[model samples]
Target: MTSTVAAIFVGFKQLGIADETDQRAIYSRVTGKPRLSLMKPPEKDAVLAELRRLGFTTVPRRANGRQQLTGRAAKKVQALWIAGWNLGVFDSRDDAALIAFVKRQTGLDHASWLHQAGDTIAVVEALKAWITREAGVDWSPTGKRDAAYLGRYGYKIAWAQWRILHPGADRIARKGFDTFVVATTGTTGMWTEISDAEWQKVMNALGPQVRAARKAKP
Candidate 1:
C-alpha cells in the first residue's frame, strides 16, 4: 500500500528529471531556491518542500498528537477547514484550532455521530445545532393578527401603528389589504381579491420596520 507521503514522493520521481542538478534547478525556478532535503526519495514537490523547509509539517511530530485523522473525523475536519477558511476563523489551515472549534460546537472530541450512522452525520448534527443556537431567529410563530384583530387586541396601539404610513394614492387597496391580512395572519381574507401591484401596496403600507419588529418579537 502506498502511503500519501510516499505517493507524493513517487510522483516527483516519475517526473524523470535526469539528475539532482536538473531537479534542483526546476525546484529553484518554481520556489526561488532548491531544498536539498526535498531532493531525496521521501520528499519532493516544490511547494510542499518549501513548507517543510519553513518547519511546517503536515503531520505534527509531537508524541501522541493528532497528526492525521481518517473517516468521519477527516470529513468533519474538512468541513471546518472550508468554513473557517471562508469565515476568517483561522488565517490558514490550523488543524489544532479547527479541531478545537468543532469540539466546542459539537461537544465531542471526535466526529462520532449521536448514533453509529453515516460519516457526515456528526458534521451535519454539529452544524445544525450550532446554527440553531447562533442564527438569532425567533423559533416561535410570528402570531401577527389582521388589522381588525389587532384593533381588538389593543385599539390605541394597533390603530396608531397601523395608520397608513404611505400616502392615500399609495395606500394598499381594500382587497389587497385583506390579502395581506390572510397571508400574514394565516386566516381568511377580509375582502375581495387583487393583483400583484395591489399586494405590493399593502406590503409598502405595512412598512419594513413593522414587519421586522413582529418577526423579532415572535
Candidate 2:
C-alpha cells in the first residue's frame, strides 16, 4: 500500500514516462503554462509542494482549477491511470508478462515501442502511422520518414503531414529522416535525430490531435 513515485516510474519503465510527459506537455500547451512534471504519486506530492512554494497556484484559476494536476482531474485521466494496471495488475513479479501486458494494453503497433503506455488515442494514432504503410508527396528523397527515427508517433506524424501537404512517401524517406536519429555507429543515412525543441513542438501541436483521436475511440 506504500510506494515511491520513482518506484512506480521504475515499474512503468519507459512507457510511463512518455505517457505522463505527453499529458503534461498537452496541459501546458492548452493553458500556456511554463512546464510541468510527469512524476508519480509520492514524487508528484513533493513536486506539488515545490509548485506551491513557487507560487504558480496564485494565478488566475484554470479550467480545472488545480494547476498541480494540470486540469487532469477529469474522470478520464483518472481512468487512464487505473487502466495502466491492466498490464501489471495481477502479475507484478513477471517482468516479461508485465511488458507483454503493457503492449497488449497499449496496442500501439510501434516501430520500436519506446514510449510509455499512453492514452488510448495516443496509442492508436501512433499505430495508425506505424501499422499503415502509405504514400506521400516528396519531401525527402525517400518519400517517407524512416520508421526507426520517428519511433511510432514521430514517424507517423511526419509521414501524415507529408501525405497531407505532399503526396509521395519516397521523398520523405530520403530527406525526412536521414539525420533524425543520433547514431553511435555513424553510418551513412542510418540514424535520425530528435531534438527536444522539435519534440516539444510536436507534443504541443500533435498531442491534442492524438488526444482527440483517443477520445474518438471505443
Candidate 3:
C-alpha cells in the first residue's frame, strides 16, 4: 500500500492487466513481471522504481496480494478501484472494442493515467466527450427523459420489462407512448411493452392456451 506500490498497481490497471497472476509476476513478485509476458515490464518497473525513490516500500506479497498493503494503501487501492469501475475498466464482459478504443483515445497506456487531479479531470471529460461523440447524445447518463404518457415511475417499470426482453439495448431513445412499442420491436411486432393491468389481461387471454400446453406436455 505504499505510494510506490500504489503507483505500480495503477500502472498495471491502466494496461488492463487485472489477472492476479500477471500482477504478481510483474509488480508483487521480487523477480518482477516475466520478460516473456506480453506486459511491457520495463515501463512498469520504471514507474515502480520512481515511486520507490518517492518512498513507497517494496513489501512482500500478502496471501491475498492486496492485504499486504498498509490500511492507507488499501484505501488508495479502493479509491482507485471505484475510479476504475466508474471508467468501466473492471467490466471484462463489456464491449472489448469500446474499452480498447477508450484506452487508445485516452493514452492510458502508463502508470500516470490518473496520477494527478488535472489528469483525472481530463480523463473524465475525455470519456464523456467520447461517449457523446461516438454513441450519440441519447446514451448520455442525463439523457433520460420522462415518459410522455406513462408519467414518471410507470415508464421505468415498463422500460425495465422491455430491457429484460432485450438485454443488449442500453437506453430508451425517447420517453413516449410509442417509445416502448418501438424499442421492444426487433423485426416488427415481435414484442411490446404493456402495463401491469394490460399484462393481466394478456394472461387471462392466454390462460386457456397455457392450460392446453401444460396438458399437452409429455
Best by lDDT: 1
- What is the lDDT ranking, best to worst? 1, 3, 2
RMSD of each: 17.9, 17.9, 16.1
Global local distance difference test of model 2: 0.36
Cα lDDT tens digits, model 2, 38-62, are 4344344444333333332211234
lDDT of 1: 0.41
Ranking by TM-score: 3, 1, 2
Error of 1 at 212 (Å): 30
Q: Worst 10-residue stretch by lDDT in candidate 2?
A: 82-91
Estimated TM-score for each candidate: 0.26, 0.25, 0.27
TM-score of 3: 0.27
Candidate 3 lDDT, 1-218, residue by residue in tens: 44445556654555566787765664434444443233354545465655444454433345555323232223333332322233233332223332354468677422343234344555556654543342222222223463333332223333433332344545545334244354433224323344544433332333343334434547
lDDT (C-alpha, whole model) for all candidates: 0.41, 0.36, 0.41
Q: In terms of lDDT, which candidate is stronger, 2 or 3?
A: 3
Candidate 1 residue pairs that clash: none
- Candidate 3 overall Cα lDDT vs. reference? 0.41
Clashes of each: 0, 30, 2
